[model samples]
Target: MSGSGTFAFTVHPRGRLREDLARAWRPLGLVPEAVYDAALRRLPLPPVTMATAQIGGERVGDVVLVPFGARHLLADVVGGRRRVGQAVDRAVALGADVVGLGALTATVTAGGMTLGERTDIGVTNGNAFTAAIVEDQIRLLLDRTAGGGSRPHIAIVGASGSVGSAVTRLLARDPAGARLTLIARTAPRLDALAADVADSVEVAVAHTIDAVADADLVVLLTASADTLLGPQHLAPGAVVLDATQPRNTSPDLRVQRPDVLIVDGGIVSVPSLRLRGGDIGLPDGRSYACFAETAILALTGHRGHFSLGNPTLERIDEIRARARELSHLGFRAAEPTSFGAPIALESRSAVIA
Candidate 1:
């Protein structure tokens, strides 16, 4: 990762056809599913050059958007892999020093292992900083909401996945007395993760979202394409950190449970960059943590594949350190955001009012 070189941040469609107007119009005969099928058959569509990013008043890198449609999530593993490779190929062709995989591109490729093998450029799944950011934000949220009083009970959904598991490990390593419950579809993995923790941290295992209903803070990292946590699954005044692509927390929950604070995980505020187009999906000064990881790596001149698979505790620590170094240069977490919009302080106050 050289400061003079450019990097590509690969982003995918959020695996929901309903969000795409072209695909969403199929039912009324306005458009046909065959059109979407043809698009899928095309496999990895041509890489779209998204935007050029400037960091600290200098041109640092450019962002690329890759559209690997929803079919990749619907039991098309081979197609998913091809789409990932195509995105990597485009980045490599564009002379990117490194490429950061966003959303399903990272997960479906098994933390970018297979894609990394296909390209010579550095690659990252972006989970390392995502975990670090989520952990730091959780502590900040607690301090604001709970006033640093007593230890809070925490629940991590999809605890077996890479991001979820990393979050669990980092939080467990903290000296605080917060209790944690690991929730996933499998019991064996949950049991194994719990056994890995130190004895001082109270930890348990559950296989359902219901287990989080009593938690004071919930971190949602599930890979499910649909929503899991609803109004009923949150306790009053509970804060949820949603790290998934399609988002584990539903928008309906905002109306159903206004008391619950649902913040989009891994959004950072960058002071240097000015965003132009609508491709990257962030407001004026905000960025996704995954993209920020790539920029930080490039800025710090870290050249190598990072955050692959389940990152080791040491690796997570190193990424956090680098991110902090960037923070000194004006790369820091932005104000809390939900669905790419600024979350107004009055909205939260209105809920309490």
Candidate 2:
């Protein structure tokens, strides 16, 4: 495939109020779902445009957007897969070379395996990139914490999942020999993952939130659509990377613990494609790494499934190299943000003691 031949279609759940108002206004002819639907069918969303750049010295193209909203999850629960399928198909029709499932779409599609099988274009869960970014953020935290004579205690929430498993593997290679904690709903799977990493680092497993209580650095990648981490679960000076899009960090933390640093994992900025009128809960010039992975792959003319199943070290190195080569066009983590603004990590010596 030609490098410029790569295009992307992103399927997101429809916005709740938009969908509801569209339905309510249909009888009055004030809003027409069909017209909006036809427009999406004919053109990719505007603020969502093609990013022209080189990844690994190869050119690429991308299509970006906020698909539907959170209600789509409820629709899926009510057997509304057809609506989701329609959204996916629309992107495919718009010259998309591959379609990336973002946030809930990824989880709904069963890690992109089912979505790939169903869509005409290639599909990626984007978990591999998420895994990579989480690892990177963790390492940065470890370095900062170690400067103060505190050896970081690493914790992975949802450690049994594919993304979590990949994170465990990456951190095990840490030369500081940090203590590792794996938390998940299932003990058996946690035990299995722990065994896999036992040679690289000391490992412990817990089947509940309490597993995170003593961790100095926590990576939240749980599949649960609810808040899992709060002030009570963390130490005073903890560094957390909330990898889940809707956010795995609790709102209470913002009100209660200003001393902790929480960074949104997968945040990145794309060059040349300016976001105009969409709100995907990101700072200006920032995007999720999963979104960047698709854009990077497209830029490099790579049509294969770059991130799928359990990501390996080889996959991480390949993508990292591609990102570096495309440095001029690549994405970086947005500054540390919590509750819609930059977080100031205050000295917590009083609290720590």
Candidate 3:
């Protein structure tokens, strides 16, 4: 497999809706907040190429803006999907080998399948590797904090989703016994996911976050833009692995509950990477797993939609295999980080106290 091709992914506004707008353009700083939001509803800037890097030869990293905030996208999924489809069109025009849905754009498209009709080129939500990273970190957390003999109670908030379901199935297969609780907004979907993993381990399904309070560990994979988890929703000394883009954990939750451990999930670091036009809330070398997925596909000469819909064990394993093949080039998972800071063993172990 030759590593020669162009890769691009869609990006949306990060941080506060109005502030994100002002940061992107200096002129918007003077515009009133009300008028700025009103303009965003009616008029969206066309797919703009914010930053691109030619990482030796044909290996190009292009970051394109879909130009909408998270709340807006969550509110108007149909419109967001259309906007992301347009962004993919821009990527196709640039001769991208693969286009990826970044941030909440994947939520809007339901892991990229909703946009299938809009493009002949492959589209991926990059949930496969995202799931993989979270799974790895959880294993590490459990091994370190619970010792090898204990089966810490684990709850997945978005257990029916691509990332959440993949982790649930993966953990279920592990030899160490751990009681699993699948929490999601949809009861039927939660039941379905529980059924899928029940043979390997015992599973309890719930339709709300209430089921998580008793669990030792919690994983958030909900697609909603809202901050669904807080101190009240979690038991003291609980560990949370959050994989959502805008993040399901509230800043206030972190402030009020120092006893709880909430680690940012699926954040990876890419080697020698230079990206502009967006801030992924990391230093320079790191990125979200979904974006890293597209980059790996491009460099590996992998064509077709690599990761889409709910992630599977096969997809998770495949991405790891690909990453291993190119491990020396350095597109792999980084250390556990909460918010933007690195999480230490002491920091995480305190949650078990």
TM values, all candidates: 0.87, 0.78, 0.92
* Number of the top TM-score candidate: 3
Better of 2 and 3 by TM-score: 3
Candidate 1 lDDT for residue 302: 79
Top-down lDDT ranking = 3, 1, 2
Question: What TM-score does candidate 3 reach?
Answer: 0.92
Q: lDDT: which is higher, 1 or 3?
A: 3
Candidate 1: tens digits of C-alpha lDDT, residues 165-284: 888888878847788989999888778888988475889889988999889889888776677888978888888888777677777888898788887887877876664343455655
Q: How close is candidate 1 to the true structure, as a TM-score?
A: 0.87
lDDT of 2: 0.63
What local lDDT score does residue 48 receive in model 1, on the 0 to 100 scale?
Answer: 66
Which residue segments of model 3 deviate by more than 4 Å?
A: 22-32, 53-59, 147-149, 347-353
Ten consecutive residues with minimal summed lDDT in candidate 2?
A: 344-353
Off by over 4 Å in 1: 1-4, 15-38, 41-44, 147-149, 275-278, 340-353
Could you give candidate 2's per-residue lDDT for residues 54-135 as a string of tens digits? 3334434344444344444544432324434555565566666666667766666566655556536666767777777777
**Which pairs clash (backbone N, Cα, C closer than 3 Å) in model 3?**
none
The Cα error of candidate 1 at residue 262, in Å, is: 1.1
